[model samples]
Target: MKFLGALDDVSLGRTQRCNRRLTDPNRLQAIRDTGLMDTPREEAFDRLAHLAAELLHVPLTIISLVDANKQFFKADFGLPSPFSETRELPIDASLCRYTLEGESIISSNALADPFLKFHPSTGPWGIVAIIVLPLINPEGHVLGTFCCIEPKVREWTAQELKVMRELTASIMTEINLRNQITKLKTEQNLRDTFVAALTHDLRTPLTASKLSLQLLGRRHPDMPSVQTSVARVNQSLDRAERMIQNLLDASQIQAGKHVALKLSECDLHAITVQTLEELTAVYTDRFVLKAEGTFQLMADPIGLRRIVENLASNAAKYGAPGTPIEVVLGRSGAQVTLQVKNQGNPILGEDLKNIFEPFHRSRSATESAEKGWGLGLPLVRGFAEAHGGRASVTSSAEEGTCFTITLPLDARARAQTRLELLTSDRVAPASDVSVSTRE
Candidate 1:
């Protein structure tokens, strides 16, 4: 935290010995060896210049990468041109020569630096004060100079200088990190594409095997035991297909490649009732729908069904055998709320927040359930939030637990409703068609 004028006497004294070498040719050559001058190399330097100008509150900044003959602007902010030719000046005229000689930040009055005193733009551009620091890559190459220029003689605060240097370091690190991350993502995408293709190729054989098993089960009616085994094989094939589907969905979400929702106004009551009926056949007397209002909300029907089914499946799998898994839906003001309540021992306090995160499960549930991969809740939350709704939970040891989701039934919902009504009119058979009761 050295302030303005604290380094003035030293800097002014240093300025008097202006002919001293601040940086050496060997070091400059090492920086040039980075091959930073050829490929989209300007972005990193320009980013550094912009950041330096912003943070230092200077009128101009340039990330100048210098070589034996010329200085190329890697990045320049508030400067007239991208570069300045070294051929136009004497050997003593390069600002970066001072940077190389000092091997540290060089902040001085341009007028005082006898080296820059002959520069034609120095006075006209009002470049009285300037600070420059080297951009050193991780491999110890001084690739460029991040320098800021001011119009008038201003005291350079130590705090400001420290902040500028720290920013320069961060910019270099970020650029390196971005390059690494981009490469990793590209490699990962290739691997994922290969895995997906392999899965698809393997699925054709699995389907064929499944059909052969079904044919064996049908052709050998006399052997009941053999038929049962074939049926089991069929079930295994179905399970594998389902797993593949889940994997694809997860990959799509990760890669941001999911198809956008074709949203529509869905009858909340119809959705709940239909989902409950489907779950009851699967769970056998475990599902219940407790309605408080006849409400229509805006949502993607397939997505909403998936969310409800996952909730009901969790309740039936973990709750006390005879306890009802309740599906509750209602509308209040501009929001529609849905809750699935089950009389199961509440999850631990610490585990509640983490339950919705991918690949997380409760200790209690893990001990009880033999089959779960801990992806259900995360998928449910993702679907709900994607529809502009939120999923939450409330639990108490004595009262069991309820997971609720809320969605807005505002103008967006109404627009979706109209679109659904129009599509329904066009697609449904006359006998099966009916007008929507949306208000």
Candidate 2:
């Protein structure tokens, strides 16, 4: 039988080939990513360990995860004493680490083996015979081992070795399946939250608008208070309109279609000024605008207005109360840029990546004074992208959160180009012509 020659070097304090693979950064990262390190023993892994012990006819079994600092017994089946309670061992003391770069390591008698005789688990803990199968993930990184240990000397059969290998593969399969299910569950929870918030958001504005209209019906049109009620209803409807448009645009984009825009010559600076003016009745004295030059661009007025409304409204909602929501408009080369900056708790780096996704509300957003529909930023992105432009954001505690939209000076040309491309790509036979038109 082959003995572990590297163990001799380890006793004399020399780095061996197995140690090189054992401390690999990628291998360590795979173990970390599993989220199993130092966690409580789980029944699923325990059951697998039990099955391994039964199949391999061993007194102890372990589903181990090796990291740089330690080896955790994720499934500590029948392990005795300090180990059963602690479920971990220092990396150098862990026998499982040696199997990381090998298919399997079988020791007939740990106490009699030339190199393993001095190992603690064997020499002191009465665990003598041992077999270890490395658990390599689909990405080819060896995480740790599925090990079976016994107190008495025993030679592992070919069939027992095969069983250990199959069990090790099952461990990785279980990990992958568990991770996929967790991902699906998280997405499902997010969808459920989005639906719940969307319903409440849609109902609030409509209910307010209805109440305002009812008030106007009883009050005389010439009454001073009637104008205020009308403005209130308009603002409520505008909010509802933006939400609805965003939803529809999301659907269109999902259907593999661009947000069809009606592009025309419009002043971006004028749109920002007007949007702020309209919002003044709601967020009075809350907005500050700085415009240095004429920022005219060929774009959809309603789309651009929706962009301004969504961004400015978002700022008002998330910004600190009574703090100014600043708007800056300027032309850079042949494109116009609009920046809306607000002061509030900065967005977290992790949450920023998914901030513009439909139905994504950041942790800061959830904790803010205002609860939003989660459609505003996504809508802002949809319109900006559909108009041959892009939307980007930056957030920091010192400078505040700012969303910038950069749109080409002539976006109508983009729509025209897309239309031409579609027309040229769709030459079909007479029978297929009708189906083509349906697009």
Using all chains and alpha carbons, the TM-scores for the candidates as numbered come to 0.62, 0.49
Off by over 4 Å in 2: 1-219, 254-256, 421-439
Q: Give the Å error, residue 65, model 2.
A: 41
Best by TM-score: 1
Residue 190 local lDDT, model 1: 94
Top lDDT hit: 2
Candidate 1: residue 19 lDDT (0-100): 32
Candidate 2 clashes between residue pairs 3 or more apart in a chain or in different chains: none
lDDT of 1 at 250: 53
Candidate 1 lDDT, tens digit per residue, 243-339?
Answer: 6655555554555433134456687788777878867866898777777866766556766777787888888888877888888887888888889
Tens digit of per-residue lDDT, candidate 2, span 1-439: 1233445654433235567777688877777777788887788899999998887777889888888778888995788888899888888677776666665667888776756775555666677788878888878887888888888988888898888888887888999787677777677567546755776688686777777677875677677677776776676676676566577666445434566677677778888889899888778878889888788777888889989998998888888788999998888799888899999888877788888887789997898777776877888888898788999999999999999999998786677666666677762222211101111
